[model samples]
Target: MRGVFLLLGLVGLCNASVLTVNDEIHMRSKRSSESEMTRIRNMSPSDRPNCQPGVTPPKIQVDTTERLSDLRNRFTAAGIHGYLVPSEDAHQSEYPSNYDLRREFISGMSGSAGRAVVLQNKAALWADGRYFLQAEDELDCHWILMKLGEEGVPTVTEWIEANLMDGQSFGVNTYLIKNVEWDEMSKDLAKKGITLKGVTPDLIDQIWTSGRPDQPNSPINALPLKYSGKSWQDKINNMHVAMAEKEADIMIVTGLDETAWLFNLRASDIDYNPFFLSYAIVNRAANTTILYIKSATSKLTASPTDAATTETVQQHLNTGASGSCSGRTGMCVTVKEYSNQQLQNDISSAVSTTTGYVWVSFGCSRAVYSSITAERVIQDNTPIALQKAQKNTVEQQGMRNSHIRDAVALIKFMAKLEKEVKEGKHWTEVKAAADLKKHRMAVKDNRGLSFSTIAGSGSNGAVIHYFPTNDTDKDITTSDMLLLDSGGQYLDGTTDVTRTFHFGTPTAYEKECYTRVLMGHVDFADVVIVGGTFGREIDSIARRPLWDVGLQYRHGTGHGIGMYLSVHEGPGRISLSHSSFISDEPLNEFQFFSDEPGYYEDGQFGIRLENIVMVKKATTKYQFPGTTFLTFETVTMVPYEPHLIVKELLSQQEVNWINAYHKTVQDTIGPLLADDALAASWLSARTKHMTLENETGSGNQQTAFLSLVAFAFVTHFIL
Candidate 1:
């Protein structure tokens, strides 16, 4: 629900930047490294997921002509005229597994985001500006590369309108399309006499039976109440309260995070994310909550069902008891262990059995709705998201506690890198990432990394999401800037922190850039939002300093972060840009976000400073009566690298902010480490404030006494 970019909204019209160009367009690329694979292999067998979602597989050379020919056969067999393959899994995830790379499997374009439209006669693929260069490099001659967000380059819908004839049949897998999206597209297409067909048992799957990766059925781990901060029963109660307010009889939750949060469970089914695939349906009035998880989940714990009355899938399929929801006691917690198509069939039966109104969240797909026998479908965006986004006191404290451990791990890794580099020892990006991840996992209740460690060095740092492979990995050198943007998945909370450092003495320009970026980050972090300040309204504070210097970052200044859930969890964000995900709302208390602002000089270096902070009610002296004020509570306890910062550029106020934040980091993380350890020394040295020439006298002070006297004297003499 959070990660997937816009599918095909092609509006910001401009002259097209054709992909087939002589000049190489600078872009970000994600690569899986050798050390990472070794780490994966070294992990315990139980920890190994069937498919590593984060691992960037080698460039797949898909024969477009051959694949198109095969697809056309299926299209002919199914009597389908056209099909749309998006980079979407059944859950509509941002990064689907290799098993679900249907778009890449057919199109031969391997950008993280893109869509392919295939017709019997012609086929085309579309990518936004981010992948224009990549598309040119990866796309074969068989597919027409359409540059999205360009002038005269129509959106998928626009292309369909301009090209396709009336009375044509267009098909898509219903599971990959949300009900809302399908309804909108169907209505829009129907106007032109186009029939939108809902295809089941994916057409791609039909063609891709040869070497599809195994579906994940990883064992489920129960998230203890200490980590979760609430029992599943209590969470259910909260959902029921929202359901009552919505006046919906039944609520369907499909988002992975939503499901994971609803039912206190975690797994390694998806890479980086500790989540298991599942569906949750809760009835407000009936007080029944049905959790349909994999068979592997059943093996994780004893069947939470009465063995005497428990009906297996075989029994359900044989008889018409397809909707059996077996419970542990006389409670409403029904755990239906299933595999393969059982989840779909069981969900269909479960929702259809209800004669009352069915509430589907934003994440619910058209496939789920197609089989429903409910009287009505209510557009009920899951309230559990906002509920979970605003962490409770326990979760807040957990986050603070978790970051302390994470800070220690990071300090050790960074210190190790500094020592190695200073001693003229060679270190690679892969080694750096592996070493950091290793330290992270050694902490208490550490699952693994929150995401792939973004350990970029020198020119590599310029690539915002640059993940190193053996081929592209850079060696750590004194003359390069290392941007270590990494996080940990601790049981207490999730951690995301970025600190850019230069191993060698930085140039004047580099110091200025780093300080300016740091200034922007602190400015945004220190903002006290008064009277319903939406995140978008206050986004400029992070960019003003960068803008003043004619520099800007491509990505958003800040994004919402989840506690022990998704690193980029949403429903709210601190961004000026509007998308399908960013909803306009007041910045609420306990909501966390990574306050990061950066500058990137292509083929040179990138600098970004990020710290996760929780929103809290601001106790301001001056505020409009009857209005609320909000501020941020620093949660990420890591220290900033002082070497790269030009302290002379910082104002007294900025210097104070750094000193205060460093003190907090020291106070929180200092005790967590051993007394005689290298980490403690490193932390102390890293956080130690740089002494400016003067607190009262500094650069660019126009309102100085001399200036004021000169102005006054000049005016008096003139008079």
Candidate 2:
């Protein structure tokens, strides 16, 4: 209820559509970014940061016993034996809006990804390893904790099958259950004589109706084609052309990124992710579309389409210099608020023209498909996800520009962190995260962080996806292996990167593991696209070094990143586990993904070095028939800590990769710091060439001081 999530929530009435491209706009987005950067530069750092360094908000007390009792009553009233609650929105997004966090509301377990299953007398919550420790502390006594992905851990489906009696009924909110999941669950439950029912008037919502936050009244606006590269018209044209090939009447874009790109619109409905919550339907036959969203009373117009009869719409596109929504085929997209009656009526009318069926994403919730009055619903395997992943010329350039600026901010954070620790001052985990956010906010066009900043120090770093809190705040020291994973959301691009740093001399084991992780990072990222390329294939390259050392992290090696969208986007990714979730598309030019290899030892240290890299044409000297290989070009600009490297352990190529990467970091960050002396000095010292002597240097305070001031004169003067 924080905001009407328009990202993947669409109630569409499309009259088939097609497109014709308009004149391309160049760098209007760049200009906008520059203007935003100028504004941030003009303001003080304290004035810009959205996240403040303070005590973590107290946890909201929810009575699980009372909630479970009430949910059971609702289940009985609906003639259901059990109900399943998942932490998801209508779209099966990893990060759901606050309004859709039903599982958290019911069970008091607050991880981003988790689910709760409740019956008359029994209830259990399933959380993966990342959330296991946190979940144990957060979940109440009544709920059984099922640690997913662990040995002997039964899947929720398997547990339901084994626990439920024959002929018993199972219920879940159809609006929340993804279509594919519903299909699988229904079939599984059906085989056991259990009826799977789609129950709504969700018990959780009913229990806390008055206390729920209201959705924001922010308007959805045009994202300016300069940033998008393609007009919404061009995007729709592309989709319609594909729609024609598939012989589908319409493609229902329920994913937030899909809808955002399709319309070239962005809004802050959810935190960090610059998107509004709305549903969109575009017709492949006629130039008509319908969007279920709110009215624009602020800066952004309500409806920017050609024309609309509805009074709810208050904004219109200027069609002049702006890369506005209405550009080609005279597409008039209707904008409206959420209304079940209106949506059903409009969708029914739209379905009347299409003969075959309505095109919905396979990932769409069953409730979305059931609302449409088509003869049948056909699932679209070819979704907008891939198109979004493969960046255009403009987007690729924008990514480079954004990350360069982002790199400066990150270096500033690390530099400040080092200065504080070296001065023998105490720095808490939350404080480090705040400093990072503060630095990112000072950069131009930064909307907010891409996600919650992870500044895990010592043992906290072992917990992947750990959110630092005042309760677990560790004092960052000179010797600890601090895993800092964070990213920024800029107008031009979204950036994700991580670095494990050490201020003092590292232990032998730490250095070995760090160097091995670094080797794996460089090795995997430097890998050429050989035969039968898949996520798991490259993932092994990152894990082999750690595997040899009899150590491994619990998480995936890498994941796809979005351009100013979700930090973790998909269609392609590199992960040993759950690779099938990503489409098996061959890695293509400009498709961005993370190259992160890590090592986490319980209660001792955690080392992870991550960089956002892109698949690009590898310069080939020797080639074989039927082979066109791609290589990753690292885009993240930040210096690696030299003291932790085991120089002898690294191959020459790995060492070269590190040095070249460090030079790029210095070259990229030095100029940004030319205007700030202290930060410039700090970055200059951190990125000095990595070598065996430096790696083996004695741990002396005097030597650390001279090394820290490696280039004092250069730091003071303009580059």
Candidate 3:
């Protein structure tokens, strides 16, 4: 998942000079204002550089004293005892722009997920297991690190209740709080006699006056019909059908990805995610659609590169020859400035026109929820999420095509890296990640990285979402376990894959752990589920193998992926979590998601194997009435590390599955790598037939040869 960061300048010590500290500060500020400040305000239509994952931003220092003091002053002025800073933007987006990173700025923790509370006397940051080590490395002593899900660590609400005094007000930005979150917290705090106030103009915003980046205002373009598979008009018609079924007169679309998908639009407002900041309103009774966006038509027309895109969108919406949708002859989308005032007025008007119910997702912001009458608003998961999760015919084909190309790039990188490490040529994790991206970019239809590359080596692999930064980079060695989790965004589709590799011989314990993880992955992929079964019902299949040995990983087994859209999609997931709305969605055909299971030993090594699998109809021996069977089609064509597997531990069924999958990999991706001999050889070596035989067999001999190669390299380095 993508996170947020602030673009503040790096604070460095100044040597002996004629300039005073104040003078130096003034000069640096002037320079920043002249260049960086101007660029932020006047952004071009082109996409900004992709974010560097794992690498700390310039502002990630071990000190937050000055910033905390400023925020405390604001809390005092607002007459609130404490303030809560969440990790979402006004749109409830998971991957917010750099401008909306108040939580990171005040707490000094940059992981994608976390919550922070600041009182005049004490401050604490709550992070989950994935970020515990990262939080320890980044946060200073001024803040207490509360590891979430730990036995003694309390949740954010529980912590607030324990810390705050009775009748004291705790402030939060209502625009950033989801309706469900606000409702639950308000009720919970009211029982404790604590006032949960909805504060305007966030307290952090008041204090972060300088050095904060400007809000994103990128160009909007239409996704081609070939890529989208369905027209925007057809998608809206489907929405109308769902709306009619729900008895909804008006529907509010607040999720950024939902809006982008609804209009067949794409933008670079947020990195990695091809989404723009906008709101949509759909009226089934009135046959009206409205899109609220910043500088709506002006920004689209300003860029010559977007001329065709603007025309396509205008025609697709039926705006007519006038190039606008004001009092048009046919039904069309009306574009308006994206502002809170304008949106609230429109919502009020829509609600006023409808005696029927207004539909909105429970994830909608409290600010939007407050404008509607309580009796008329119906809150549930948005219908568009389910519709998007199931891909159409064209999208399914594109996913397969793009993944083949993606495999070509990944296999090339793996082969080259393995060869280098065997020859004793050192490569840093950052450099290796860059080389992988170079290969991905050379492929056709590549847009950019789906997310920051997770290229962790040795001890770094224990960090689940480890990103290699200049400060934490490690050299690739034969003795280290390297975990590479990365993805690419193509014009056709989106992909996410994780593969763990060891260039040298592994201990028996390591081999056993890897085999168990592989067993889970194979089992989850091969199981046939009954129709209407929820994801949680089947999630344990991926973890049962590990659980048998009293070992389990901390993260979810899988999450939904979009086609050239958000990588971490929702309303469908495979996890043990009982609280999330997405966890309850039933397994359906045409749905694509990941199947990843792993085991990690803290400060030693980590092992995870992942592939994107598609849900499809399964042929069963017997069919019961009103019951349908479904299985998965693994689209990712990369081969697993052959040497890491303990073949004797696998059942014949599991062994057959591995052999079949490797054969498919060679058959599908083998021809594409014909031009690259080294990569072809590497693929052939790894994908060879596996058997539960003795160690002196042909497959084991090949493994021994590779080990000898690594040993020679290590011995040469020693000399």
The C-alpha lDDT values of all candidates are: 0.68, 0.67, 0.76
Among residues 3 or more apart in sequence or in different chains, the pairs in candidate 3 whose N, CA or C atoms overlap within 3 Å are: 54-467
Cα lDDT of model 1 by residue, 172-270, tens digit: 999887676677667766876887888877888888767678877765656667778887778888887877776777887777878888776676777
> Candidate 1: global Cα-lDDT?
0.68
**Which 10 consecutive positions of candidate 1 have the poorest summed lDDT?**
13-22
Candidate 2, residues 427-475: lDDT per residue as tens digits? 9899989988988998888878998888888888876667788767888
Which is the better candidate, 2 or 3, if ranked by TM-score? 3
- Model 2 has an lDDT value of 0.67
**lDDT for model 3, on a 0 to 1 scale?**
0.76
lDDT by residue for model 3 over 1-719, one digit each (tens)? 00100111111111110001111111111222334434432322122111223444333345788989998888767879889888788888777888898889899888777788887777887766667677777776667776644444445566666667788989999998877777777777776799889899888888888889999988777888888899888888898999888889899999898998888888888888888889989989788888888876674344424432435455556663333576677568877788888888999988887887799976788899998773777788777888888999999999999999999999999999999998999899999999999999898988888888889888888887778889788999999889899999887899899999999988888888989899889878987776776664555667666876799776667878889888877777775444421214777999998898887788888888889999999999999898788899999999998889988767666788899999999999999988999999999999999987653434543453344334423332332
Could you give me the TM-score of model 1 versus the true structure? 0.81
Pairing residues by index, what is the TM-score of model 3?
0.87
My TM-score estimates for the predictions, one after another, are 0.81, 0.82, 0.87
Candidate 1: clashing pairs of residues = 14-151
Clashes of each: 1, 23, 1
Given candidate 3, what's the lDDT at residue 233? 84
Score candidate 2 by TM-score against the native: 0.82
